[model samples]
Target: MFPSKDAPLKIGAFCSIAGQVRFMCSGQHPTDSATSFPIYSRLLKQPEPVANGGKPAGITVGNDVWIGNGAMILPGVEIGDGAVVGAGAVVTKNVPPYAVVGGSPARLIRYRFSEDVILQLLAIQWWRWDDEKIKREAAALTGPIETFIERHSVAGTATK
Candidate 1:
């Protein structure tokens, strides 16, 4: 994670970040500047960075996300829950929940599950469940999505 006083990298629970996975929160070149050079930062005499109206900032990774080896996540990119970032992917944009993204400036390859299932999981938000609840449903959590949803859905109310 690149250190930025202003921009922070917020990671959620159960993330599997692989080797060389970079969360670049800092090192943003002043693209709005005329020359795209940080004159103030480089030269003591120069004034502060030019007014770059829109600068990308921060990285947010949600729960159950798996970032593969050598993945580079750029500033202001948000990886949602259950998303899979492929190896060596350079993610420049926000990845949606349950998405499987790959390639340079990563594109959405697919979602891990169908829309209905994704919605069900989002609503259930099993990752946020208490320790006892998680332990009680360990088998279902590790098994199939259908089973998990069936057991934990609003109608089922497995928690109760």
Candidate 2:
């Protein structure tokens, strides 16, 4: 129901893209007294178009991210790279890189890593590393950050 492989499209890791990810609006409705009644009726009768109670926008997911089962990513939301959205999270805003977010409104619990370490990892761009190289470094990948850095630090650089 989407473009074929020949077309250029972006996909992320472990995400279940059921509906229109690019142009999905959780569809929020205003709560003013004048508008609320009609919206409430519409919501009771039919809820799909009014997912976020009728806001309109699209969602953008970056690479290497995992969106858990039954998660509802709302419109105009941009999920950054290496982020993890827990199951049943109703994301209503943009998620930063490597963030682990959950809950209805989706508050930021914590970053996946320290800011400096995250920056280093981003600069390393290890996601682009070949499978074999990654496999060789699998132990280090699962090891402490300092150990990984010490072992995999740039050539000719002192181990700090």
Candidate 3:
């Protein structure tokens, strides 16, 4: 949850958040407390106490991420770049960059590519490209990885 104005939820460029995807942003209620009712009064009368207390950290989604339909991304989870969240997955933790995650609480299925490839892609960060650049590299975007890399790799940057 982004309680602080400074730490707003960051969703990077080229993200695909499919229909019905849920983001649980705030978790201020204490489970051990007798009842959750008191927090509501606190919220209504004095906002500062509830705002500062026990709230979950903000969620961050990096560039080129794909969150599938019906997936639930919980509070404080940082979904990394190029990661894929499968349909119906309940993501409760941080997703590593370029990792494919699926299932309840979202366990890692596999990396989208090998470590070398991932490193290369991370270095490239093609999602940051301008519209013209992306359009120019349309073929590479849809083609095989080898070709994509070959065409776009330029001194460790993915730009023309």
Best-fitting candidate, measured by lDDT? Answer: 1
Can you give the TM-score per candidate against the true fold? 0.86, 0.62, 0.80
Candidate 2 residues lying further than 4 Å off, grouped into runs, are 1-9, 13-57, 153-160
| 10 residues in a row with least lDDT, candidate 3 | 46-55
The lDDT-based order of candidates, best leading, equals 1, 3, 2
lDDT of 3: 0.78
lDDT per residue, candidate 2, 42-89, as tens digits?
A: 556543244544444446677678777667776557888878887778
lDDT of 2: 0.64
1 versus 2: better lDDT goes to: 1
Predicted structure 3: clash tally? 0
Cα error, candidate 1, residue 25 (Å): 0.6
Q: What is the lDDT of residue 151 in candidate 2?
A: 67
- Which residue pairs collide, candidate 2? 26-52, 27-54, 27-55, 28-54, 28-55, 29-53, 29-54, 58-76
